[model samples]
Target chain A: MNTLDARGYSCPEPVIMTKKALEKGLPLTVMVDGVTPLNNITRFAQNKGYKVESRAVGEDYELTISK
Target chain B: MKNKQTLLIAATGLVVGALAVLLTLNGNPANMGFCIACFLRDTAGALGLHKAAVVQYARPEIIGLVLGAFIMSVAGKEFAAKGGSSPMTRFVLGFFVMVGALMFLGCPLRMVLRIAGGDLNAVVGLIGFVCGILGGIFFLKNGFTLKRTYTLSRLEGTWMPILSLGVLALLLLAPSLLAFSESGPGSMHAPVMMAQAAGLIVGALAYKTRLCMVGGIRDAVLFGDFYLLYGFVAIIIAALIGNLAIGSFNLGFDGQPVAFNDGLWNFLGMALTGLGSALLGGCPLRQLILAGSGNSDSAVTVMGMIVGSAFCHNFGLASSADGPTSAGKIAVIIGFAVVIVIGLANMRKEKV
Candidate 1:
């Protein structure tokens, strides 16, 4: 599993970057802050039907997706 | 000229726009509300031109609007192929307009409808739009002009309708490539045929009436004309009723579906849209109508809108379900500067 630290990115950057990461065909973990990013990234992964697990960690979030 | 004719057009536009929204609720897209700007943005997303990932679809209403308007133009013999008025500038304006609308999370039509639906942030947006359009009017009064267009061969203009047809064909044949959202904003859509029919009806009426919010406001302010602006009011009344009937009126900005409540950005974003639409000579819907009539300038504007959506999504300038991004704010600032420069540099001085 590859982990993406998207803590600093906003809006579509995290979504776009995650899309780029997915092009490499790997299970992934994306760390984000706030519910909007979580919703965007979660929707992105779920739209592609990637298995995802999300949990809150401090002020940030950890989202794990499996290929 | 005639009250009956005006009333007919306004009523038809209202019904068609409302039906478009209701259809969106059934299966098309949520809160779409007959916006060429937003539909073109979504079309850009469906093509993977930009990976917003949340809002992507080859909206049938967009296709329907162009095709519908084309049919009306042909039937009425009002179709004339013309263009070449600072095409590149118009394209950029269209693009920036989309970026601004996305930042506010809706187009001009949707902006008004959102307000009618009780989203108070739209009040800020509407104010911004009016102010922006008034700014464009100032440029106009000072002799800001895009180059005039001459007639083009009819065959050349037919290509836009053909392109729309091709899109419709792709939508029906390879639906998967359209890339609808399964669980987000894109997941919400009006029914396809219903949406298309609504668009077709609205396009036809708008083609006849020259229905455009920016044009309406600009004309009212600049020329003391209120005919076109009345249609805008009609749409608000109709959409408000529809929202009430559907139980979607929320009366606040905080939790409105498909909208964000960042007051400053909301105001500025729509102001940018209003200004751009004014400079381009029409709102997004009017641009589509112009394109259908073979105005390549409008076509270029439409293309620019699609590209702008791609740029906004890819560059983090678009607002999301959460709110507007910082990049979106910066882009709006830059976009405003760009519009100001375009207006100033392109102003034509009267020859002695």
Candidate 2:
């Protein structure tokens, strides 16, 4: 289970980073701070054949992307 | 991925545009909403680069944009501090982009906003922009290139943002360091916090999507891709709705605020802008965003635009409601010739 910290970041960068991580064939947890970034990361994962489930805990978001 | 990107871009455009309309309603200026070149000119004037009294303000929006993008880029771990991509060439390109935009009284973003607000003059400008883009495409196909940029220290990317924050500090604590117009276009602005917020949000969004009108059109033209264009189309539609809600929609061409009816200059001016922006690789707003993202080449371009703005106003080369001065006409003509020469001279040899 790999963990990626993408908190405090903005949009496309988080999404791009996530894509790179996925390409290396790793499935795990990604953290995004903002609603925009969280949503974008989720979609970027899903569109690339990954399953995404997200949870918000007190203003921070954790996304689990899996095959 | 493509569809989601389009949706995000559209959503960003809608919200940002609504803010622009709201700002205009709050006394920023009609059809004069969210113009990068105008704001740059105003900032240049504020810094005493030129003496255009009516158009001098260190727009908080521009500062916010740079800083916000800086913050996001740093946090995203996507910040690359590099440049040196033909700085002088880019500077001249920025100068001409601003000149062309000023002649038409707006950048491509503002052009769409204007037309959405019902300014018909922008249609002609649009035509010119497309033609210029077509010319630029001709050069690109013929191997026009600006060569590769060498990477520099990450500290290089930090300079633009650091400078932005310092300016923000100055604007907040020691306003006397910079000159602000007591009246005229410079005096007109949305509230500081509001403009800054708008700029910050936009900077963040732009950094993410890499939203660029010139890039979008260039892609659409050269590669037959509409992914970028979709975002722009959504922006216009969103702006149109915003204008409609506020009764800012004035369909006819004449009597548009801060703009006049000389259609030829409108066309020619935007043509210059289109070509210049294409040659330079992005529009003025994109340049600002890229500067925030740590591109030093873009920083030089921004500086070029600032100086060009000063030159235009100081030399009586900017157009007014009475229409373009003869000097402005001559400058536009010269701008076209110079841009064409740049396009032609910069072409690379075809590969074997």
Name the top TM-score candidate: 2
User: lDDT tens string, model 1, B129-223?
Assistant: 99999998788766676755655688767777888888898889988776665666665677778778887888888877777888778766764
Error of 1 at B302 (Å): 0.2
TM-score of chain B of each: 0.96, 0.97
lDDT of 1 by residue, A1-67 (tens): 6778766443334565576677666778888854535765775576577877899997578998886
Q: Ten-residue segment with the worst summed lDDT in candidate 1 chain B? A: B24-33
TM-score of chain A taken by itself, candidate 2: 0.87
The positional error of residue B100 in candidate 1, measured at the CA in angstroms, is 1.0
lDDT (Cα, 0-100) at A12 in candidate 2: 36
Tell me what fraction of the real C-alpha contacts between chains A and B each candidate also makes: 0.00, 0.00
DockQ of each: 0.01, 0.04
Question: Where is model 2 more than 4 Å wrong at Cα?
Answer: A1-67
- Please give the clash total of every predicted structure, in order: 9, 1
